[model samples]
Target: MTKEITIDDLKMYRALVETGSVLGKNTVLNIISHAGEAAETILRKQNAIDTLDRIITQQCQAALDATGLHHLIDEDGDGDWSAVWEGLQELADQKRHAERNADTYQKLYEQRAESLEQAERERDEWRGKYDESETARIFGEAQQERVRALHSPEPARYYGTDLNPNRQHDCAGCGEGWAWPCGTIRALDGDPNAAV
Candidate 1:
């Protein structure tokens, strides 16, 4: 049958064995052996408990340090977890406010970038229209000069039959001895076969 034995009982058995008591030799040896075994078991259990307690303390300290809440640790070097909870709540509030500000700044940045891009596009469009209008204005002036040249009056020239019979009807404008219609006039009139 199994029975509980205390440290006191084990110590008493060990003392009796050491004192050479009247108990039978085999019985004293058995009690001494059982006492040693019980002491070893108790020591092992106490070591395990100490190790577990140290691990728990270290974990609590690490938690406090990681959360920036080390101030919440009590005077005895134990964590006041409820105070840490309050500190965490304040940290969470600050984080939420920072995130909201970041989101608002991000939105403003996007809007500003979009507005800049739109302004650039509009500026480019206006530049293109201005370039087209300037080109058209230059082309119209050139066309007007061409039309004025075609209709300009030429100075009259007289060629006597005896002095210059072959050039009797020369064009006074270009000095070309052609008929009434000259090459310059014919070319301006859209005649493909006319010489420029």
Candidate 2:
């Protein structure tokens, strides 16, 4: 017998295609969800930083008023707003520079101290919650893989599948084709065993 195709083969191919589509969709959703959560965390920290800036501004204003600099640079015949603004700007710039140039060891010590302080504030319970969540995520991923493996249709017996990406096969199925790959098979021309 030269070659022949059958209906059973087509059914197998269709099942494999369907399974791959499901896996791709689910994996994409998982990645997008993770990214969204991380983005929210970053935004929360950014908002805190903005609040800190506002507090610093108010404090600077109060300092200027109390030091009589506001009166000395008074242009509105009320307060020296321009000089106050300039001097405050200079002070803010210096503070930012100092923060950037902070000694690594000193900064590390401060960071550890702050983290320790926070941990204490939470009574060590916050880390426990984090540990539980991490454990859950790890197991959830394992369960997902198990479900996919158990549910995803096995590769087409005769040739390849979506999971076996490099398997030799035709991209487009022929009209009632069979075992031997036919019609625009990518691997046919490029395959190592094919005519060189």
Candidate 3:
């Protein structure tokens, strides 16, 4: 029967049988060969994996046969988690908006700690350059440089017509986060339509 069925019909049938969705019409007809019990196991496992977290996915993949959850966890009916698209999009938007406009106290704390480390190093440099008393006096004379250098503004920055301050740097806000943007870390995201 499949031999007579067109590729489009096959893909549609696959999508319907595999995910019960009409998505990924592009690959609907690519599963004429999978129109059997073997396809059921593969599609079932694929759904299971898609619904799982990374640790669970790995553990399940390790223990469960490939025909099981492999298709689900990393499946993309049309190359995406068509089943959880809305949930995923909502999470992304939440993170993005939260990162940009919410209480970034946690992120700012990290930046502060980093700045403190830099400041400590700079203070050490000053101490090496001069006696502790002299270093203290110099820093007390102008705390702005010490503050900027330690807190951030390390790589480089130009606040005003102030030609340059020996060690200015790009601002943290330049890269999204005032210190560490979320992309600094990437959470796992799987797509089934990707190449093997």
Candidate 4:
């Protein structure tokens, strides 16, 4: 272990620099600067040493083995706790990766569900529009049938006990027969088969 520099060392160095003559002040100041650098290096090394000591102490206190040595080292008697710590870190990383994958899959499922729902809604809307158009088309055809029925003339009819005079005139309305208009023409007219 290296010796720890103290505030007393700094005080002594300062006193030496102040008591030095004007010509030696520069040399003393240079020496003090070098000492400061050395102190900084020592402080860094001490910090590292303190950190390692704390880790070793904690590892020994929390040792899994009854001997308090197997958990801290390997079978070859070397300082190799890297495998255990690395394995633990890998497990933690894997857990985080799985969680991230699960979250991504859940979001994808939600998005697909929303898309399917939207498609179903659009299909239903289109079906409704088609049904309405079909109904309108049927209604329009019914209206046309009603108009035709109202405009077309009905076939003329006569009740019993009142003989129909125009019964012999099958083609009465349209004078296409030879004895048409008044049924006065004989069968030997220009059209011989007029009565049949």
RMSD (Å) per prediction: 9.8, 52.5, 38.8, 12.8
Q: Is candidate 1 or 2 superior in TM-score? A: 1
- Model 2 off-target regions past 4 Å? 1-23, 71-196
Point out the worst 10-residue segment of candidate 4 by lDDT: 178-187
| Candidate rank order under TM-score | 1, 4, 2, 3
Give the alpha carbon lDDT tens digit for every residue of 89-131 in model 1. 7778888999999999999999999999999999999999999
Q: List the residue pairs that clash in candidate 4.
A: none
lDDT of each: 0.74, 0.60, 0.53, 0.63
CA deviation > 4 Å runs, candidate 3: 1-88, 98-114, 129-196
lDDT of 4 by residue, 1-196 (tens): 3876577865776676678734377786787689889978999999999999899867644442433346567554456556555655666788899999999999999999999999999999999999999999999878756543333222334422265545433333333332232222322234565465
Predicted model with the maximum TM-score: 1
Off by over 4 Å in 1: 1-63, 66-76, 79-81, 141-196
TM-score of 4: 0.35
Per-model clash counts, in order, read 0, 4, 21, 0
37: Cα error in model 2, Å: 1.0
Name the candidate that leads on lDDT.
1
How do the predictions measure up, each by TM-score? 0.41, 0.26, 0.17, 0.35
